[model samples]
Target: MTKKKKIKISELPNFDIVDYLKTDKDIAQYLTVVLEDGDPALFVAAIGDIARAKGMSEISKKSGVTRESLYRALKVEARPRFETVTKVIHALGMKLSVHA
Candidate 1:
């Protein structure tokens, strides 16, 4: 019989989606998948991830929202206003659209 080696939990590298979101298409697809999941909190976290990837300061500048406010609004379990969500999406250089 062959023996198997065990790996410690700490041995695994941290997986951050923000690190992989390198392009607009990547962000779009990520958000799309999260939206399909239909979990509001998950969607918010996904947006936060993309925001971090793009730079919170830059997003705040483009969205005309304070960086602190962006962080508060995008955090998981945060029930931010629809207007704020739109602002962040626009700031991210994307738009929200409805499909039939």
Candidate 2:
């Protein structure tokens, strides 16, 4: 009988969410789905994902918010101020829109 070989799960290549959010259309569709769900915290968290995908330092520089602050604000359950949220959204090349 031949011996079977097994690989540990951790030994497998890691999956990075940021890699999946590489394009503008991909990010837009992802956020749109998250927005339709209507969870404020989730929306902010998605922003965090986008920030990470685009590069946190760049997002921080563009948003005019420090790296630490950006992480805190985008964290789960964090209630960031409107200005901060807007800055983050714009930093990710996105803007809030309303439809009548």
Per-prediction TM-score, please? 0.90, 0.83
lDDT of 1 by residue, 1-100 (tens): 9999999999999999999999999999999999999999998888889999999999999989999998998989799988888888888988888999
Structure candidate 2, residue pairs in collision = none
| Cα lDDT, model 2, residue 2 | 100
Candidate number achieving the greatest TM-score relative to the actual structure? 1
lDDT for each residue of candidate 2 in 27-70, tens digit (9 for 90 to 100)? 99999999999999988898999999999999999999999999
Model 2 worst lDDT window (10 residues)? 14-23
Give the clash count for each candidate: 0, 0
Each candidate: what lDDT? Answer: 0.91, 0.91
In candidate 1, stretches whose alpha carbon ends up further than 4 angstroms from where it belongs are: none
The deviation in Å at residue 56 for candidate 1 is: 0.5
Per-residue error for 97 in candidate 1, Å, reads 0.7
How large an RMSD does model 1 have?
A: 1.3
